[model samples]
Target: MGAVAKKELKQYFHSPVAYVCIGVLMALFGFFYTQVLISGSSSNISYVYSNMFVWCMLVIPILTMRTLSEERRNKTDQALLTAPVSTMGIAGGKFVGAFSIYGLAMTMSLIPAVVLSFVGKPNWGMIFGEYLGALFFGMAMTAIGIFVSSLTENPVIAAIGSLGIAIFLMVIDSVSSAVNNPVLSKVVSWISFSTRYQQFTSGTFDISSVVFFLSVTVAMLFLTSRRLESRRWN
Candidate 1:
């Protein structure tokens, strides 16, 4: 798993994907942070984090688009599958590699908050919770992208598919409202990413939200592994 992850990371950096994704994320973060500072709206860094929700939907897909898709396209997936590693290991390693790139961008985004501290004190606990929420959100999105990548050898298609899924999750609550069945609507609402993310911006560590994000991440990764496992038999 570690070897796979290391290889994925190396691939990410060796190409322009890692640099482009990280640059875009940090640039967006800087833009939002600057707006917050100028507006004097809220001292809490959660403001920037909250505003970044939609931007992440764009960035994460690009980050994970090539994880598995590129391997299949280059006919390297067969070699990896026949290796001594389990499908789960490959999926997990891919997830880690993609998420690590995202994590680095998120970490660098903290520099703005650090600079803000010189001017005024921000709520550190709230910032922490927001960061945690963003990380979990990124994890789930990365897993979804990986699963999408597994379905197609084309990275462009994988990216579009992942972005579509992210957009769907964002508007799922609105879609649910159009449905008449109470139980079904309630069930659909349970997977609303924006709702779960909003809970963390309030500075309260909600266990349920954490669980929801992790469950999504795990389920997507499991599905990705299963997809690979099926390919192995074929």
Candidate 2:
């Protein structure tokens, strides 16, 4: 798994994907941080963190689109499958590789918060919660992107499919509220990623929300592994 993950990370850096994704995330983070500073808004950096969902929705697909789809398109996935590695290992490795790049970008976000601490006392606890929440959210999004990538050989299609799903999840909170059926609304709310993510921005450690993100991530990776297994047999 480590070898696979290293290979994926190497592939990302060798191409433009890693640079572009990380650059975009940093640029956006800086922009938001600047806005917050200029506006003299709340000293809490959670405000900047709250806007990260949009950034994840934009970059995660690009980071993961080629993970499996391009290998299959190039007829290289057969080699991987024939090697001494399980399908779940491959999926997990891919997820880790993509998530690492995102994690690095998120880590860099701390610089702004650190800088904020110099001028004004920032809420480290809330900042910590927001950071942790963002990583969990990114983990789930990366898994979803990998699963979408596993379903197609076309990288563009995989990216589009992942983006579509991300957008759907983003709006699901509003959809849940608008639903008339009580049971259906409850179910939709349960699955709404954005709603759960917001729970952490308040500086509280919510174990259930963390578990929900992990559960979704594991389920998506399992489905991706099953897809790979099917392809191996066929």
Candidate 3:
């Protein structure tokens, strides 16, 4: 697993994909930071973090789209399946590789928070919570992308499929608001990613939300492994 992860991480750095994703994230973060600073909203980092969901939705697909798809496309998946590693190991390694890039990009984008600390008393608790939330959210999204990628040999198809799912998840919260049925609304809200994420933005460290994100990530990766295992047999 470690070897696979290292190889995937190396591949990420060897290509422009990782750099481009990081650059896009950094550019979005810079724009949000400037807007927040200019608007005198340094005290609240939630806006900046919340806005990042949109950017994550865009970049995560690009990052994970090629994970399994490229292997299949290049006829390398056979080697991976016949190797000593388990399917879960392969999926987990790819997840970690993609997530490491996501985490590093996010960490770099937190420079604005450090700068704000010098100027005024920023809510460190809220900032920490938001960052944690973003990390979990990104992990879940990346897992979903990985699962989507496993379903197709074409990276473009994988990206589009993942993007559609991401958009659906993002739109769930909005859709829930319009529903008048109480039970249905509650169910929809409960399933919405933003609903759980909002807790962290509000500086609330809800253990359940953390578990929910991790659970989704694990479930997706499990499904991805299953998909690969089936392909291995077929």
Candidate 4:
């Protein structure tokens, strides 16, 4: 698993894609950071976090689009499958690699938060909760992208499919409101990413929200491993 993770990380660094993605993420973060801190004179960092969540909808798909898809495209997936490593290890390794980059990007984005701390007495607890939520959110989104990458050999298709799923999750609250059945609507809202994330942004460390994000990450990784295993048999 470590080997696979190292390879994935190395691949990312060796390619231009990683740099481009990081550049875009930093640019977006800078925009929000400046607008919220400098222009608005607000000590609240939640706005920056909320905007990052939306940006993740696009960044994550680009990051994970080629994880498994590129392997299949290059006819290297067979070698990976036949290796001694378990399917779950490969999936987990890929997820960790992609998530490592996501975490790095998030850390870079937090520089503005650190700067803000010097200017005003922001709630440190709330900031911590927001960062935790962002980490969990990135993990779940990366897992979803990995699963989508497993479904297609074409990276473009994987990216588009992952983006579609991310958008769906982001807008799930609106979709739930259109449902007439109260029970069904409640159920739908329960699974919405925003519903869970709102707790953290509001300075609440809800255990249920943490579990929900972890469950999504684990379930998606499990599904990805199963998909690879099925291909091994075929």
- TM-scores, each model vs. reference: 0.95, 0.96, 0.97, 0.96
lDDT of 4 by residue, 72-188 (tens): 999999999999999999999999999999899888877877777777666678778988998998899999999999999999999999999989999988887887889988797
Tell me which residue pairs clash in candidate 2. Answer: none
lDDT of 3 by residue, 21-120 (tens): 9999999988887787777867756889899987887899999999999999999999999999999999999999999999999899779788877876
Candidate 4 TM-score, C-alpha based: 0.96
lDDT of 2 by residue, 1-234 (tens): 888899999999899999999889988888888877776754647778889777777789999999999999999999999889999999999998999999999999889878877777778888888889999989999999999999999999999999999999899878777868899887887788888888988777889889999999999999999999999999
RMSD values, in order shown: 1.4, 1.1, 1.0, 1.3
Q: 1 or 3: which has the higher TM-score?
A: 3
Tell me the deviation in Å of residue 167 in model 3: 0.4
RMSD of 4: 1.3
**Please, what is the whole-model Cα lDDT of each candidate in the order they appear?**
0.90, 0.89, 0.90, 0.89
lDDT of 1 by residue, 137-185 (tens): 9999999999999999999999999999999988898888888999978
- Which regions in candidate 3 have their CA more than 4 angstroms from the true location? none
Model 2 residue runs over 4 Å out of place are none
* RMSD in Å for model 3: 1.0
Query: What is the lDDT, from 0 to 100, of the residue 184 in candidate 2?
Result: 82
Predicted structure 3: lDDT: 0.90
Better of 3 and 4 by TM-score: 3
